[model samples]
Target: MDLIACHDCDLLYHQPSIAEGRKLRCPRCGAVLLQHRHDCVERCLMLVLAALILFTVANAYPLLSLDLQGREQDTLLITGVIELYRQNQAGLAVLVLCVSILLPLIKLLSQLYVLLPLYFGWRGWRLPVAMRIVDILHPWAMMEVYMLGILVAIVKLASLASIVPDAALYAFAALIMVMAATDASLEPHDIWERLSKTR
Candidate 1:
């Protein structure tokens, strides 16, 4: 087993298996040691599916609707990103889209692809190292950050009009919940162990 010492604090963590990826984490500072997720792969997979459903609602439905001056306006999360791009903040728009929308989707899909088959006793063991890439991407996906931003925007907009939260907003919040649960539950080593055993 490979061991990694935490850079922030003096603690050591074991690599999930082979020296394939970076150390999964540093237990002391909660930094990335390597890319493996949590060990409860099956549980996390279910959460991923739930998150995907929430993600659909988050993107497809209007996030908020406002009525002011006898007019009503509604905006979806992606619409806000598009508006940002039109305002010449393409980088910021892309960042929002990727972090809030794309990353969550990728995480859900990646987790699903690996977990569903394994639960069904399929060829989960045969999947190559691409799952490692999913692990690598997990840390960067910040749905909470986006959620905070959304809350701030909602608060700011409230004083200006009759702001009514939409289905997507609720869905996004649920998505955040599910994603967090999945992140907490899915562990790479456990999945690998199960997969390896099946082989």
Candidate 2:
């Protein structure tokens, strides 16, 4: 038996073995204390793999191309960060670099590291540390916010230049959706249970 505390009401309850797809709720506040997701590790692994591919594509290709005055320029995802740094906005550049690129990449890779080993029935040293890193970096991954800012900039620049959306733009959009799905399918409680059994 496992003792679980309700995040909402702080009531502690003994967690029972629940059937797959079922949830244990807190008696006082009715907050879900534990949930059993069927094949959560497998599902999350696949989603993380897809997200990795999308992340690669998003960074490799040009996000959009600008055609202004018969001159065309293609902008990669890192262009803005580089430009910001060049303009002496080092702090903002570092912030964007970490939140939009580095943090998300690290989070995805950490998820992969944790899920892949668990899926293969192997125990890795410091697996919990990897999961902890993922949890910490979760809020710092702000690709969606960056994408929204891109959209706003595109809308504003549409009159000044002919903006053509490119492969990276689509890849970035897909990445956001896939990352969201990965987060939803990932059950931390299930992961913790699996980790506890590892040698």
Candidate 3:
């Protein structure tokens, strides 16, 4: 029997061999401890690809357009950061840039670096280390939080100006859902075991 520690209750229990597409719960707290997602790598990779395309659209096109008294203004993801800096909110600009842009990009790139080679059965350099680093950076990828903030801002700005939803806004919304699914589908323990065998 494999010993597993419950993250919620900190109770150690003998982990049972769970089949694919099944979940293992902690006996003491009844908390879901492990989920074996079959074909986790393939599913995660597909979601990541969708996210990447959406991410590009989210950055390339205007997020929202503002029409105020015959004047028009549009903003993309990076444009917001620049606007903040231009308005002398340097700290806020940095925060948005890091959480919304930099960290998420790093997470996606690293996942691709690790997963692509593994999927194709090719040996890649430093894949294990890259995967570890990606895990560390995951928490910092606050795309969902940033999306929530944007929604709130849109609500607040609606009364001030005519807020027009753009293609990027829809793309960003889809990206959030895809990213969430990717997180749910990815089984880190299984990934590590598979990676070790390939070495």
Candidate 4:
């Protein structure tokens, strides 16, 4: 048996060696104390790989096309940031770059670093550090928030112009969902246990 404290209510409980894909809830607050994600590391690794591919596609292709006054304008992920910088919105540009691109990339890479080695029976050089980085960067990965803003923009612009969602937008949208699923399916405790066992 293991002694676990609920992060929400601070209630301590005795936890048994639960099976995979199971969850333990806090009896006092009804918060999830622990969960077993059934092959969480492998699933997270695959999802990370898929998210990376989609991230590439999202950045490579045009997010949307704007047809205004018989002229068409295409915009990629970086294009918006560059344009913002060019227009003297440097602060906003940097913010967008950090939350939308840099943080997500870092989170994905860190997860890969931690998972790939564990998957192949090899220990990562700094697994704990990599895992720590992932935890720190998780809240900063705002691709989904960016996607939501884009959708809101589309709704607002629909009344005035022809806004066509492009391949990159779809890729980004899917990337958001995949990343979310990856985070949900990931069990950090399980990873830590496996890392301890392997070492």
The candidate that achieves the highest lDDT relative to the unseen native structure: 2
Q: List the residue pairs that clash in candidate 4.
A: none
**Candidate 4 residue lDDT tens string, 32-94:** 877987588888999999999999999999999998877899978898789889999999999
Residue pair clashes in candidate 3: none
Displacement of residue 13 (Cα, Å) in model 4 is 3.2
Question: Candidate 2: where are CA atoms >4 Å away?
Answer: none
lDDT tens digits, residue span 2-67, model 2: 788889988877877889899888889997777898699999999999999999999999999999
Model 4 alpha-carbon drift over 4 Å, by segment? none
- Return the TM-score for candidate 2, rounded to 2 decimals: 0.97
User: Taking the tens digit of each residue's C-alpha lDDT, what string does model 3 give over 1-199?
Assistant: 7788999999987888998888898888888888887687888888888889999999899999999887999878888789899999999999999999988888988888888987888888988998997889978989888889899999998988999999999998998888888877878877887798889
Q: Report lDDT per candidate.
A: 0.75, 0.94, 0.87, 0.90
Ranking of all predicted structures according to TM-score, beginning with the best and ending with the worst: 2, 4, 3, 1
Give the 10-residue window scoring lowest on summed lDDT in candidate 3. Answer: 185-194
Each candidate structure's TM-score, on Cα atoms with residue i matched to residue i, is: 0.77, 0.97, 0.92, 0.94
Q: Is candidate 1 or candidate 4 better by TM-score?
A: 4
